[model samples]
Target chain A: MGTINVSREYSVKEKMFLPAIIQGMIITLKRFIQGFIFHKKYTIMYPEERRNYSQRFRGMHFISVDENKVENCTACFLCETVCPAECIHIVAEERDSASNPYGVRKEKKPLSFDIEVLRCCFCGFCEEACPKDAIKLSRNYELSILSRQEGIYDLNHLKREVKGRG
Target chain B: MSSYEISKSENYLNYCSDKIRPLPVTGPDAKPLPKMTLDGQVVEFVPGDTIMQVAERAKVASRIPRYCYHPGLSIAGTCRMCTVEVEKAPKLMTACSTPATDGMVVRTRSEKVLKSRSGVVDCLLASHPLDCPVCDKAGECELQDYDYEYGPSRSSFVDEKRVFPKSSTRKLSDKIVLNMNRCVACERCVRFTDEVTKTNDLVMLNRGWKKELTVGDEDKGLYNDYQGCLSDFCPVGALTWSDFRFQKRVWFLRGNASICDRCAKGCNIEVHSEKEIIYRFVPIYNPKVNAHWICDEGRLSYKMVTNSHRVIAPLLEVAGHGPTATSWETLIPVTASLLKNSSRALLVLGTDSTMEECENLRKFFSKFVQNGEIRYFNGTGITTSSENKALDHLLRQNDKTPNTKGVESLGLKPLDVAGVNGFDTVILFRSGRAGIPSVAAAKNLILWGVWSDEEVRAQKNVRALLPGLATQEKSGTFMNCDGILQSFKKAVEHRGYGLDVTRIIEKF
Candidate 1:
C-alpha cells in the first residue's frame, strides 16, 4: 500500500478564537451572577448560632439510666479497658451491700470517673462496651474547653447530666 | 595543525564531561548521629532512646531528676521532675519518658525546663508532709534529694491540707509494718509486691486525695512470705520493717553486696550493717536471679545468728550426767575416741548446713569413724498442697532445707527413717525438731547444733552436745531448689557456742 502521510500546518490566522473565548466568558459570567445574586448565604457567627443534630447523633457523652432513675453503671471496667485511647479513668469503689441483688458485696464503685475529652477519639467504643448501657454519647455537642485541665470531665460533671436525663 | 587540534579537543572534552559527572565515594561506614546538644556537649544516641537514658550514657552534665522511674522497674512516668525542652515540641517533655529522635534538639538546663521542673516539684510538695526530720528514709529519700536540688522555696496552696485517716498501724506479717501517713502514693511497693512477688495482697484504694495503699479486707492481713519486699521497695517511709524500724537511719548503715543463703534462687542482696551488726537484708537487682525482691524468710534469717540462745562452747559426754562443757582440745579427742570405738557409727546432718560444712563433715567422718555411715536430713517439713500454687511449686521436696540439693550433688543419699533400724552413735549438725528421727534411733547421740530442741536436749542417750555455727554465723554457699548456688557472708559472730562448722569439722 502506498503510504499517504496527512500533514497539515497553518499560520496563527487559520485558528478560530472569538467563539471559544466567548463561550468561556459566558460560563464565567453565569457563575459570577449566581455568586452575587442567586446564591444563598451559608455563613453564620458560630458563637451566636448553633447547629441542629439528629436524634440518634452521638456527641458529648452522658450517662443515662432506666425509668427508675437507678444508675445503670455496674463499674465493670469493660468500657475503660476497651477504650483504645486511655482517656477514660475510672476509680471504682464497692456499691452499698444492701443495694446489690446477689447479697454479695463488691469491692468497687466509680468513685472518680474522668474522661479526657482532649485525648478522646470519639469512636463510640465506650458506649459499645458498656453492658449496663450507662455511658452514652448524647446529642449535645457543645464540648469546647478553653484550658487543657477544663477538658478533663470529672465524675461530678458526668453524674449531674446523668441525673437530669434519668 | 588542524588534525592534531581536532583530536586533542575531542579527547579533552570527553575527559571534562566525565570529570563533571557526580561519582559515588567509597569509604568507611559513616557514624550515624543526631544533631542535638545536651548541656553544651554534642552527643549521639540511637533513635527512640529516652533523653534521660541518652544523657546518662553520654555523661552529660545535666540533672534530669526522677522518682517514679526506677532503672529496674517499668517507667510509671508519674513524677514529672525530669522535664526538658525540645526545640519544636509545644510543651516541655519529661526526659525520663520522652523518646529521642534524629535531629531533635534537647536542653535540660534551659529556663523553660527549669521553670516547669520547679513547678512540678512545688505541686508535689504541696501535698507532701515534709516530715523529713523523723522519717526513716530521710537521708536516702529521692524526694528529699530532689527537693534540695530543684524544689521551689515554698508552696502557695492555702487550703487545709487533705488528711487521710491513718489506718490502724497494722503488721502485714511478722516482717513488715505499714505506716499510711508517710506514703506518697508512688505505687512502687504495690507494683513490686504484685508483679514480682505475684502476691496480690496490697492494692491502691480510693481515688484523688483519698487514695491510700491497703491490704485486703480488714481481717485478712498481708500473710504472704514475700511481705517484707514492701519495706525494701518503698521509696518513702510508708512501709518499714518491724525488725529495722526505729533501730537506725538508712544513712548510718553501710551496705555490702552479698547473696542470700535461704534458697537456691540465689537472690542477690545487700547486707546493711552498722558496728559489725547486720540491720537488714535488701534484695539487689539481678535479672538472671531475684529481681529487686527476696523472701521474708530470707530477710529474717539474720535473727538466728544474733539470738542469745546459741551454742558458744564445745562439750563432751560425762558418765552419769549430760554432756559437760569442755575445751575444744579435749572435745575433739573425746569425740574421736567415741567414734573410733563404735562399730556402726552414723553421721546425721541438717539440710540447713552449708556445702563447705557438709563436705568437711563427710571428709572427717570418713577418717574418724572406721565403718560409719553418713545420712542427710532436712530440718523442716514441706506442706505443698495449697491453692497458692506459686509458693507450693517453689518447694522442691518435703525437706525445707536450703542445701539439700547441694548434699545430693555430693553423692550422699538422704537417710530414710523407715530403713534405719538403729545405730551405735549419731551426730547432729544443726538444731530442729525434724532431726529427732535419727536422735531417737541412735544408741548414743552427739549433738553439734546451735538451737536446742527439747527432744534432742532431753534425750538421755545423747552423749556429747556441742554448739555449732548457724547459717548466719558463717560464710558459705547454699544450693537452692533451682540448683543455683548462692553464697552468704558472715552476718555476725555467734553469741553462745557458735563456731563455724568448717572449723569444727577441722578439729576432728
Candidate 2:
C-alpha cells in the first residue's frame, strides 16, 4: 500500500573466494597424490591367483551321487532333450533286476554320457533339466584344452571328476 | 567445338557417387562377359549357395564332413559333422546350411570347428548300435568314417543298452524293408519322398527315443514307382529292398553305370552286379533327365535279364514238329534258305531291337530277301499320349519295351496290322507273340525271338521257332522319347550259344 521499492535489492558479505578455491584444489591434489605416489594396486592376476566363488557359482560341470556312492541319475533324457544347443548326449540303459514289481524295479542308468564343452554356452540348462540331481555345474572353470578333440568331456572323464568331487 | 563442350557438361552432371557409376555400354552383339574372380579364382555362384558349394566351385580343398547333404536331394541339416569356423562368429557353424557371403572367410578344419565336429561324432555314437560287423551299411556308412576320425576310443555306456528292432528284419511292403536299429535318421529318404517323388508315402513317426519310420496302411502301401530311391537315398542300412535284403552286402557288388531298359524314358541307372549276375539297379543323378529317381518297374527290369525263364540258346523246329535245340551253324543255313527260296519274305522287327540292329537288319534283308518287307511289333500297345504326360498316365502306357522310339528313330514305319496280306515266309524278331495276328497267319513262320508265348508257338504253319538273345545279352544304344541316346553294355552272355541279333543279321 505504501508503494515499497521491492526491485533489485542487494546484500553483501565478506569475500572468501581464495580460501574456498584453495580448499577445492587441495581435495583434487590429495586425490592426484594418492593415485601416483601412495597407490598399492589391488587387481589380481586371474589364472595365477584364483578368486573364491560363491556357494551357488556355476562353472565347469560334474555329476553328483547319493550317500551310497551310486549315481543319482535315472538316465532320463530330460537334460539332453532340453539343451538348446544339443551339446549334452546321454546313453541310457536299464538297471532293474527281474524280481522287482510296481515298475519301480526299472532304473535307468547312464551307460555313456558326454557334454561337448566346445558347444556349451554355459547356460546351465543341462543342470536345471536334470531331474535326478546327477548333472551339476561346479565351481571349476578350467576347461581349456590343447586340441579341440580333447575339449569334448567323455563319460570316463566326467565320472572321475564327479567321484572326486562327491 | 559446341558438341565437345556439351559432352563435357554431361559427364560432369553424371558424376554423383563413386559406387553409383554407370557401367560402360557395350555393343548389342558383344560376346559373353568374363566371370568375376576372388583370390585368383573364378567367383561363380547363385543365391543361397552354401560354403561347401562355393568351396567346390573354387576347387578349394574343404574338410567339411556331411552325412545328409547330398547334392541330389533337399538339404537336411541333421548330422552336425560338417561344423566349420566362420570369422567373427561366436561358435562354429554347419558348412552345409551356412550361406556363403561375398567375403565370408570359412575355415573347415579349424581347431574350434574340429573340436565341435569331434564332439558331435562322439555324441552320435553314444546311442548308436556299434554293430558294424553285421550291419549292411558298415563299410559305406558315413557315421563309421566320422567315428574313425573323430570319435572316442570306447563307449562309456556300461548298462544294458536300448535295442531297437533292426529295419532289415521289418518288412514294410513287398518292395521295401525297414531296419530301424541302423538308421541315423538323416531324413534323406524322407526328404526324397517329400521333395522329388512328391508321393509322401514315407513318414518319420514317433518322438525322441522311440522315433521310427512308417508307411501308410493304404492298399497301395509304399508302392510308388520311385520306392527303390529310398534304398539308394538311405545313408545307413535302414531302408533296403526286400529283394536285396540279406542277399549280399553292398561292398560285395560292383556298380556299373547303365541305363534302364524298361521304358522309353531311358532313366540313368547303376547296375550292381557280381559274377555277371545283376543283383540291383539304382538311379544315377542326371539333372536334365531323371533328377534322382527312376520307376520301380525300371529297377526290377534287371530281373528280366537274369531270370531263369530267359531263353539261353537258339532252338530250331522241324516242319510241323516241336522245336529242337540246334547249333547256330544249323540255324544260319535254315534262315538263309528260308529267306532265299520264299517268293515273298517278311521281316517283323520287335521294338526291343537296338538302333544298330534295326538299321543293320533293314539293310541285310534289303539285300537277301525279296522285296525286303519289315514290320515293327511289340508286346505293349502303342498309344498317342504325350511322353511328358502325368507320371500315372505314363506308367499305365504298358509299353514294356525300352526301344520303341529307338526303332522309330531308325526310320521304320509302324506296320498297318489291318492291311497285312499273307506272305510266303516270315522271320519274327525278339518280341513274344502279343502284337501280331497277321504274322502268325503267314505260311512258313521262322520265329527268331527270345521265347514263344505258349499260344503263338502252337499256331499251325509255324516252321521253325528259334530262341534269340535277350536285351541284356547284347550291347547297343537306345534313343529315348526325348532323343537322349543311352548306351548299355552287355551284362552277361546267354547260357547257351545264342548270337546277338546284330551279329546274326550281319552274318546273314
Supply DockQ values for each candidate.
0.01, 0.01
- RMSD for each model, in Å, please? 34.1, 29.1
Interface RMSD, all candidates in order, equals 16.8, 13.7
Worst 10 residues of 1 chain B by lDDT: B1-10
After TM-score superposition, the amount by which residue B353's alpha carbon in candidate 2 deviates from its true location, in angstroms, is 1.5
For residues A1-166, what per-residue lDDT tens digits would candidate 1 score against the true structure?
8999898885564476776788889998988888799984567667688676566676787766445554556565666768998898775554554574422112124667889988888888998988666788876777878889999888667653353322
Residue B1 CA error for candidate 2 (Å)? 59
The 0-to-1 C-alpha lDDT of every candidate, in the order given, reads 0.65, 0.65
Q: Model 2 misses residue B189 by how many Å?
A: 1.9
RMSD of 2: 29.1
CAPRI tier for the interface of model 1 = incorrect
Candidate 2 structure quality by residue, lDDT tens digits, B1-508: 0100001121221122222222433698654433333334556554456665655555552356777776666666778777777777788777677776655666666677777877777666666666553344556667787777777677655765445644434667788867676677788877777766677777888887777787755566786677777876676767767676545556657776666767666676777887778888877655444655687878887776676765556667765556666777787788788778988887878777777778777888898886668877664556321332334622323566667777776767666655346578877776332244455557677776566345345556666656666665566777666666767776555565656766677665
**TM-scores of the models, in the given order?**
0.62, 0.65
What is candidate 2's lDDT per residue for A93-158, written digit by digit as tens?
544435323122123367778889888888888888765667888777787889988878876676
Pairs that collide in candidate 2 are A111-B156, A111-B157, A112-B157, B167-B178, B167-B179, B167-B180, B168-B179
